[model samples]
Target: METMIGLPFTPKVLIVDDKPYDVKILEMKLREVGCQVAIATDGLSAIEETRKFKPHLVLLDIRLPDIDGYEVCKRLKNDADLKEIPVLFISAYGDVTDKVRGFESGAVDYISKPYEFEEIFARVKTHLMLRSLQIQLEEQNKRLEMLVEEKTKELVEVNKKLAMLDATKNELLQLVANDLRTPLTGLFSVLDSLIYEELKDQLTKDQLKAYDKAKQQMLSTLEDALLLTQIDVSNTDRVYGEIPIQQVIKQALNNVRPIATSKSVSIVECEAKDFKIFGDQNLLTRAFTALFEIAIRFSARHERIQLQLGTFDHHIELSVYVIGYTIPPDYIGTFFDLSSSARLNILGGELGIKPAIVHRIIALNGGSISVKNEGPAGVLFIIKFPFI
Candidate 1:
């Protein structure tokens, strides 16, 4: 006897027939091939055995002693638990009408009487294989559903944690900004009053220069902190419109001109045909001002910085070349990350947070900024904005 392999388990078959010799032959052949066989001489007995055996396939004869095979198939198919089991009809009535009725009664296949035992075995094997595959598919689908449910729950928990962290961070930023800005504002008022000619005469040239530099650095740091907090908290209320790129650049230049002059770093602006981009004009100008200030601060005295603008296929490009300084290669990767220790160390004091602010502002306006070493001794900052 050849053992049936490759199935998840031994195939169980239910045979329903009135003939004793026919039933015995089929039962012997099924058992020889490692099938567990159950016999029924009537339709009701077949139904009973099917429920008890939970067989993989059913071989039913049309003429049953108690109830017809068609009625048995119908009853089995009506039961939710038994419906998936395939029923193959084996009957002496080998007519087209009988086969049609068998199919209508939910039989999977129909075979006429006087059929070869080999043909019967072949049909049984095919249906058993199909049942095995269906069981495997059902098992796999159940596993996948379970996995998806588990992952979805994990994602929900992660999102909740992230939301809590974000809220805490915003609250902290607001507190820090309020505490620092109040003192800085009062100091600026005192400094403005001290700028009067009568009061100014009290300080020497070196004293005045140091006082001015200190004031500028403090003011810059305060402004950057306040702006960063505003950007984080009020993103939804930003005013946006189409603004000319040249006008924005000009405004930024004017804003940074005093510092640039103080550092003796001249900026050369290259003219291009004006292009308009959609963004918050004030924010864009502030971003550009921050970039120019960073370039100016890092450049040597009298080093000329070049500003150029051009249009690409989908976006407008602005490039600033700081002629005297190049960022070290390692720091370039995390230059715009506010939390990066390297960036904090390199751009110390008031300038430390400006790049991160610039990056956020550009991102909010659907723009991007990047910095890289250019030529032998210069750093280049490239900014791209969507063309309107």
Candidate 2:
């Protein structure tokens, strides 16, 4: 068992000297100021007392019986267990060379023979306080390291769970999309037969017209649903290549030409020069078709819907602006929203899923689609594609 010769407020100190009177005076004074003293009259005894007593501070006399104080301090400092113990020397050698030699041999402080008790105590207290602060800081660093390690482990587990959940969500979306498309296909086939084939003669003109409208609406909805499953964000299927911007625009214009002509809405195409984008061509064509259809449907009779294409920085912009129409400012924000039904009253029918799907397709290709005001004149739909 370890001995507790030291009091709670006192630190153990080792004092080495050959003079009994000097030793008695220092021992009494140090003990009075809350220091537990261990006396060693020789260098060998001082080294032994340091290992045994584990003193926090040591006061050694430079001239001793067995070995000098410098030799004792060096030996104590060399030992692994005793190296951190602060050593102070009391000596008659007051020259600069003696003090430097004492410090180089690992004495923290070297005091001359005629020293005051207050000065000794002050130096001892300062060194002890510094050592105490060092120990506390080391402990705090260990605790902080443990906390960082634990938090990193927690984050790793959370990321793993999130990845698994994402995979499950994507799988469910694919299965439901496949299930819904099968019935939608059957309905489209039946509508085609009833409107154009077997039942054409038996149905009245009003009934035929109604069936045709229903067929068109269902076909439009089904087309959008199929497009959703094709891209779906998680789907990595891509047939990306360099596709000319004008070629896709021409195909879109051709598809929407009949609808535009029927509404007496003329399109003015200010063509883009040598503009190319790297993406799926078929999807891009559909996006352009949606923009053209929206323009034609909303334009007033004899109104000119302007199509302008130009390069801006690293991206190309294809804009469709209506010169004489302005949608409600509030509805402009909701136009690109997938669930908004405000377009139903404006279009005289539901807007279907055209606008939102086009937005998604552009975003999937690392591009953007926006509807914004064209000053006092109508609104503009801008489609952006970054050049590859």
Winner by lDDT: 1
lDDT of 2 by residue, 272-311 (tens): 5788887888888888888788887668789998988998
Q: Against the unseen true structure, what C-alpha lDDT does each candidate score?
A: 0.87, 0.81
lDDT of 1 at 272: 56
- What TM-score quantifies how close candidate 2 is to the native fold? 0.60
lDDT for model 1, please.
Answer: 0.87
Q: Would you estimate the TM-scores of all the predictions?
A: 0.70, 0.60
Clashes of 1: 0
Question: Model 2's lDDT to the true fold?
Answer: 0.81
Best by TM-score: 1
TM-score of 1: 0.70
Model 2 C-alpha RMSD vs. true structure (Å) is 7.7
Clash tally for model 2:
0
Q: Give candidate 2's error at residue 14 in angstroms.
A: 14
lDDT of 1 by residue, 1-388 (tens): 4566778898999999999999999899889889999999999989999999999999999998788999999999999999999999999898899999999999989888898877888888888899999999989999999999999999999999997888788778888878878887897788768775657887788887777778877777767877887898666778899899899999999999998998888999979566998899989899989988899877879999998888777879998998776777888998898887655567454366899999999999999999999988888999998876
Candidate 1 weakest lDDT stretch, 10 residues: 342-351
